[model samples]
Target: MKTYTYRHPEAIEHTGEVPVMDEQGQVILYSQRVYENYLKRTFDKMFDFRYFLKYEVLDSQREMLFTVKKISRRGKLWFEAVEVASKKKYIISYENWRIGLPTLFITDRKLKIQLEKEFEDWSNFLLDEVEIAKWKAEFSEELGEFHMTLQIHENSPIQQPEFFVGICQATLFVGA
Candidate 1:
């Protein structure tokens, strides 16, 4: 399995470029958050309603890899991600509750994935009851930031790993 870490300032609002690094501390991808207008940007900063913003993931060469946009946010958070080259679409739904951890659902045209935070600060992506990926979150008081780690099993069946990373980025943007 390979481990990747993404560390960012612990703030409700994020903008500009954020880096995702490998276990070796090498940046593998950059995620950028963009708002449609100044009003939406200010609203996002003041509240948790991030449906007004969009996210873009770029490679080392600053080439756009994929884009994530909010599709709905009434009771649950829904997002749509499109790969730049293939134009493949992924639908991600997050079910939030007043108690307990939220549940994340990711699906493409055929495959469906269910991820639930069964423990505090830890979540696992399960496909047919088999664990394929693990996600862990830690807060650093010294740096006043949050570090998110994702570990993908070597034999994982998932094809596009970057799409999951993009979903993670969207979750971070919405405080999910």
Candidate 2:
């Protein structure tokens, strides 16, 4: 299995670029700044308080793979990943968390697990990280398994993707 690290570049103007790196520290995919106007920034800070933003995930060739948008509605975080070519959207929204286990809804699927600890920093209400695993039944002929893990370096000091992580992860899971 190959490891992927999400990295944020060091600089004021370049901080918006979040790169997904391979084990060799090479960027495989990256998030591009879609819109960051002065009015949007000021408005978000003034009213929404950083509750909405948009970005694009591009491959190494800079072709758009997905358009990611995160918005807060009625105190719930809604993250959507839209495939550029197909326009298929995968959405994940925060549900009523129970006993420190976050309830996340991906369409009709509800995922409530402690493995999502790393993503807890995205909001103060979350308490765990997110990990994905694939399982197959020995007797089944039509089961597909898709597993992905994100590995970050200790020294890179990158900001967590927040709801963007769910958008990327859910897209990979549901889209694949």
Best by lDDT: 1
TM-score of 1: 0.84
Off by over 4 Å in 2: 9-15, 47-49, 74-76, 97-101, 108-176
Model 1 per-residue lDDT tens digits across residues 15-114: 7687888878888888777777898887766657555757888887778898888765456657898999998888877777345566778788687888
RMSD of each: 2.4, 13.2
Q: Highest TM-score, which number? A: 1
Q: Summarize candidate 2's per-residue lDDT along 1-176 as a digit string, tens digits.
A: 33455533322123255666667878778765455677776675554333445667777787777777666567556667566777666575554442343455444133332223223232211213433321111222243322234533233222233223435433222211
Per-prediction TM-score, please?
Answer: 0.84, 0.54
lDDT for each of the candidates?
0.75, 0.45
TM-score of model 2 relative to the true fold?
A: 0.54
